[model samples]
Target: MPATDPILPATNGVIRRSGCAADTVAEAGAVSLDVLAARRARSLPPGVRYELKGVAFTLPPVRALPVDLPESAGGDTAELLRLVLGEEMIGRMAAAGFTLGDFELVCEDWRRRNGLADGTAPLLPAAVRPGGSR
Candidate 1:
């Protein structure tokens, strides 16, 4: 049957689980609490401690209207993380701290939630299935 049938409700009756609980996944990427305390001590200038307060990010956000991810980022999520941190958000792990692994984990989750990749999480057991339960 055509999906756009006028008689059918726009919804599937059951709200299956997707990548995110929110309606739209933030393009900046998902935040991880584990990275809240993300810090790496630096001695470049000698005893310059690094401390990130209130920001625990991984994927970083687009500067423009869900528009661009910065030209420097390319198609590489790791590069994106590296470049984005240096963009007026040193406290966001762009500084001399945080690792590629940290950023990648969050990006993976973001991808799934945004439907950019496979794995949308299984549909939760609903009270009723679509078109009504048996």
Candidate 2:
């Protein structure tokens, strides 16, 4: 939540670019998106472009509001694009001097904009956690 964060943007996300897509998953109580562009911007490999047709977002396990619920139970409700790039992508970015926490913040910002819950969990895990039920 820095003022100038590219993902969150101080304008409350009103400056979103065209073509970004988002959706809410009622069962998981989360939101998702096909933010390949955002992922690429996060420093994924050049040839790693893949269409993320549908993905979900939720709060991390440790940060869940109700500790009793599995991390899968849901914590936040935001567009999936806010989640961030996958591990391989982050690895590539890290080699190029990207900080792990920075991209995590990007995902966190996405969550904030989508009205999703907040969690301290890392982005890589949270991004993949919802797929088990798929």
Candidate 3:
């Protein structure tokens, strides 16, 4: 938790949120890979497909920690993701250019492949997939 991060600012050695920082942190904390993927997929064309490659995403000081995170989490981001995204979400992943079908496909494929239907993610309800769920 560096003092430089915008979401969790350091003032006198204490961490606190300012302005929309709370909302941003809350949103980031509540985010799930499935829902994020679905939203991204919904915006793409049916025939659209991307390639797979490595990506880099930097988390801010309070990215994985919510302003109202339950105390039981013990300040661990992995635990928070598990609580919101499920145990299958052992960590975080990100992508930019070159992928596959949109992110939704990867999440689905992972689910079906791993049989990780713990029901903690895929926040967006199932809809008529653009490309038949790839």
Q: Show model 1 residue runs off by greater than 4 Å.
A: 1-54, 57-72, 82-86, 90-97, 118-134
* Top model number, TM-score: 1
- lDDT tens per residue, model 1, 18-86: 553323323345443322222212211221122333455444222211224433344555455456555
Candidate 3 runs further than 4 Å off: 1-51, 54-95, 98-101, 117-134
Give the better candidate number (2 or 3) by TM-score: 2
RMSD of each: 18.0, 18.7, 19.0
Give Cα-based local distance difference scores for all models: 0.41, 0.41, 0.38
lDDT by residue for model 2 (56-83), tens: 2233322322323334334432223223
Q: List the pairs of residues colliding in candidate 2.
A: 32-80, 76-116, 76-117, 77-116
lDDT (tens digit, per residue) of candidate 3 on 1-134: 65387864454432234441222223523533454455555654333132345532222222223334423344343444345444332233332342334445544543444334644432222243232243
Model 3, CA-based lDDT: 0.38
